[model samples]
Target: MEDGKLTVRAVERALDIMLCFTGATELTLTEIASRVDLHKSTVHRLLASLEGKGFIMRDAATDKYRLGYRLWELSANLSKEGDPGIILLPEMERLRDQLGETISLYVQDGLLRVRIQAVQSNQAIRRVAPVGARMPLYVGASSKVLVAFAEPALHEKLLASADWPTGLDQQAFLQQLSDTKLAGFATSVEEREPGAAAVSAPVLDRGGRLVAALAVSGPANRLTLEVMQEQAPLIMEAARRMGTMLR
Candidate 1:
C-alpha cells in the first residue's frame, strides 16, 4: 500500500509538470518548477522520467522542454477502427462550426448517460461538460434521447428499478420518452444546469440499434428552445450520417 501510494503521487506530480506546458510551445526547467511549485531538483527528476518515456522531451540546444511525439501518436489513434469518435468527429466539427455551439457525443452506460466525445465551442461564454462524466439518465436532452431509444428491458428497468429524483412524475416522464421517440429528437431548456440548454438526437447503428446521442449545447440566452427546435432537422441529419458510419 505504501509503495502504491508513492507511485500514484509520483504520477500526479508528473502530470502537474506536463500541464504547465499547456498553450506553451516550450518551457525551461525553472519555469516548470515555478508553475508546479516544486523544488528545482524534484522537477528535474520528474522531467527526466517523463523524457525517458517519450512523454516529454528537452531540447538540448535550447534547454527547453516540450511535449513529445508519443502523445501526438496516441491522439492520432482515437480515429482508428472501433472508436465512436472516429465516425462522429467530422459531423461534430461541422455542427460546431455551423451552429457555433458545443457538440458532444454520449452513449448509455448502464442506466446513466456518459459523455464520450466533445467539440467545445470557441465562444468566450460557452457551456463545457467534461467528457467521461456519468450523468443522470432522467435529465438533459441527450439523456432523454438515449433513454428513448434504449433497449426495452433496460429501459423498463431504469424506469421501474432506478431511483428517480424527487418531484419527477413517472407517467409524465414516460410520455416525454414516447414523444422523443416519435420526433426522433429531444430538446431541453435549463433542465440540468442553470443557464445551460441543449438539443439532442439519437444515432443508430446499421441494424437500427441505438448507438449514441449527439447533442449541441450552449448558453441558454443564445441557444434557446426556439433556436433548437428550428435546428432540429439539421441535427437529425447529422446524427443520421453519424449512425450510417457505424457498422
Candidate 2:
C-alpha cells in the first residue's frame, strides 16, 4: 500500500477504538487492541496521543481508559442537520414565557433519550437539567412518552430487555407506558431525578409517527396534576407545529 493508504488505515483503526467508548464506560488497552485488531503497543500509543489531546483519559486506580470530559464538552456543541433546534429556540422561548416552566426537546438514540434543546423557566425555582443530558428509555416523562408511542417491536424490546438506569420493574413500566398513551402525554414526579416533575408529549413527523418528545419540567409542588393537564394541549400543539417544520 502507498504511504497515504497506510496512514488512512491507521486513522480508521484509531477512530474505531474511539467509537468503542460510545456505549461502554471504559476499557483496558489490551481489550481495546483486541477489539480493533491492532497490537497492544500500537493501541497504547494511539490512546496516549488521544489522551494528550483531551479526547480520552485513564482512571487512576483501574488504569482503564474512557472518554474524557472534554469529549462530552465538545459533543454538546454539535448542531443537528439544518439546525431546527436553533430555529425552534424562539418557539421554546415563547412556551417558557407563556407557561413559566422549563421546556425541552428530546430525541431517541438507541435506548437513550438525549436532550437536544431546552428553554429555562422564569420562575423562582427552575429545573436545571442541561442540554446533551441523556437517560434510559424507562426513566423520565419524555423518555417514557417516546418509548410508549414508538414501534411496538422497539417498545417491547426496550421494556423487556434493555437495562434501565432507574431500576424500574418491566411490568410497571409497561403499565405507565399504556397510561401515557391514553393521556396523550406523560407526567412523572421524581421518577428519574429528585425534586422534579416533568410532562412530555410526543412530537410527530410528517408521517404522524412519534419521532421525538417535547417536555416541560419544574418543581413537583408547582407542576401539579391540574397544571400538567392544562399544559398538555399547549405542548401537543407546539410539537405539532415543530413537526411541520422538521418535515
Against the unseen true structure, what C-alpha lDDT does each candidate score? 0.89, 0.84
Each prediction's TM-score against the native?
0.69, 0.70
Alpha-carbon lDDT of model 2 = 0.84
Judge candidate 1 at residue 94 and give its lDDT: 96
Q: Pick the lDDT winner.
A: 1
TM-score of 1: 0.69
Instruction: Tell me the tens digit of each residue's lDDT in model 1 across 129-175.
Output: 67767788988899889998887787678777647876888788888
Candidate 2: where is the Cα deviation over 4 Å? Answer: 1-48, 51-82, 162-167
Candidate 1 wrong stretches, greater than 4 Å: 1-79
Summarize candidate 2's per-residue lDDT along 1-247 as a digit string, tens digits.
Answer: 5999989977887799887765567999888988888899899989988899888999989999998878778868887665656766887888899889999988888888888889988777899757777787868899888898888887867856647445567788789989988978999888877888999988777888776888999999999878998889998888778778765
